[model samples]
Target: MHFTRPRDLVVAGLVALAFVYVAFKFAYGSMPRLPTLAGATLIVLAVIEALLAFSIRARIRQRRVTSALAVVRAVALAKASSMLGALMLGAWLGVLAALLPRVGDLAAATGDVRSALVGTPSAIVLIAAGLWLEYCCRTPEGGDRKHDDHPTG
Candidate 1:
């Protein structure tokens, strides 16, 4: 599968930002308070992906035969995680934009601001870890190139 492109993530993020911001602008009063640690789950997932990347890279560097299925799964997971991170980042940014101005005037906005603060950084870490995991899935130099052994002379 092809590597995940940054442009795609950016587009996804921008779209989510616009949509979320508009939605929140109108409905924020009706919404409940956001949990301060709402993004903690993303951070946990990022840590797991980082650990997996290190293990996979070590196996590749040692010339150990890593399972093809495992590598494919890792790539898929990386791709999905990165996209999720982008969406979440955009979402948090949207919420922040809507709440930051009101933090001083509204009591609820204050708590939501804290949630956005935690979520934004967590999303960023997840994106980095996902990219790292994808990079680790690559084969080392000269490791799996096809042989040009066909007779043409």
Candidate 2:
């Protein structure tokens, strides 16, 4: 899979922000409050992916791929991470945009905005982690590929 394009993410976030801001303007009272743990959970995921990326890249760079299965697994993780990061980034931006103007005026908006603010950075971290993972899959310059005579099972 290819690395995510920044422009696409930016466009997605903009569209989501516009949509959510309008919807929240009318539904703020009825909408449920943002969960406080959301940010923490995303942060945890981001950290996990970041560490995983670093470890996997190190192995790849060293030409120490253990098996075909492992590389396949890493590829799958990279694909999933990139997609999730993009989606979460857009969603969080949307909610944050809605809450911006109302932060001090309403208690719900205030709390929700805080969570969104926390989530935004975490989501960005996830994106960075995902992209790093994708980059790790590429063979380094001048690396030998003699062992890859056959695709790993």
Candidate 3:
């Protein structure tokens, strides 16, 4: 598969943001208070991906015989994580947009605002880590070559 495109991520995020904003607008009052640290889970994933990127890059640069399957798996993880991050970023932005004006009027909105603030940066970090991992997966020859190391392909 080709590299994940920024345009695709942006479109996905915008679509998710619009959908979430409308839905939350009607249901927010009935919803329970959001956990401030729930979004922070994404940050853990970002850290893992970043570590993987560093390890993979080191292996590639040292001309070690990295496994083709492992590299492909990393690429797949990176692609999925990036897409997830975009959607999450959109969702958090939607929450922020919906709750910001009401923060002064509602007590819960204030806490939810904190949640959104935490989530936005967590999602951004995930996206960055995913992109870095994807970049690290590229071959020394600039990734133009397919998985020539693969036994079957």
lDDT winner: 3
User: What is each predicted model's overall lDDT from 0 to 1?
Assistant: 0.89, 0.74, 0.91
Stretches of candidate 1 off by over 4 Å are 142-153
Which residue segments of model 3 deviate by more than 4 Å? Answer: 145-153
Lowest-sum lDDT 10-residue window in model 2: 142-151
- Candidate 2, residues 48-127, lDDT tens digits: the string is 87787788878877878788577667767876776677777777788877778887889888889888888788878887
Better of 2 and 3 by TM-score: 3
Give the top-scoring candidate (TM-score).
3
Output the worst ten-in-a-row residue range by lDDT, candidate 1. 143-152
Per-residue lDDT of candidate 3, residues 42-141 (tens digit): 9999999999999998898888845889989999999999999999999999999998998899899999999999999999999999999999988887
Given candidate 2, what's the lDDT at residue 151? 41
TM match of model 2 to true structure: 0.79
Clashing pairs in 3: none
**Can you write out model 1's per-residue Cα lDDT over 94-143, one digit (the tens) per residue?**
99998888889889999898999999999999999999998898788944
Score candidate 3 by lDDT. Answer: 0.91
What lDDT does candidate 1 reach at residue 138? 79
Q: TM-score ranking from best to worst?
A: 3, 1, 2
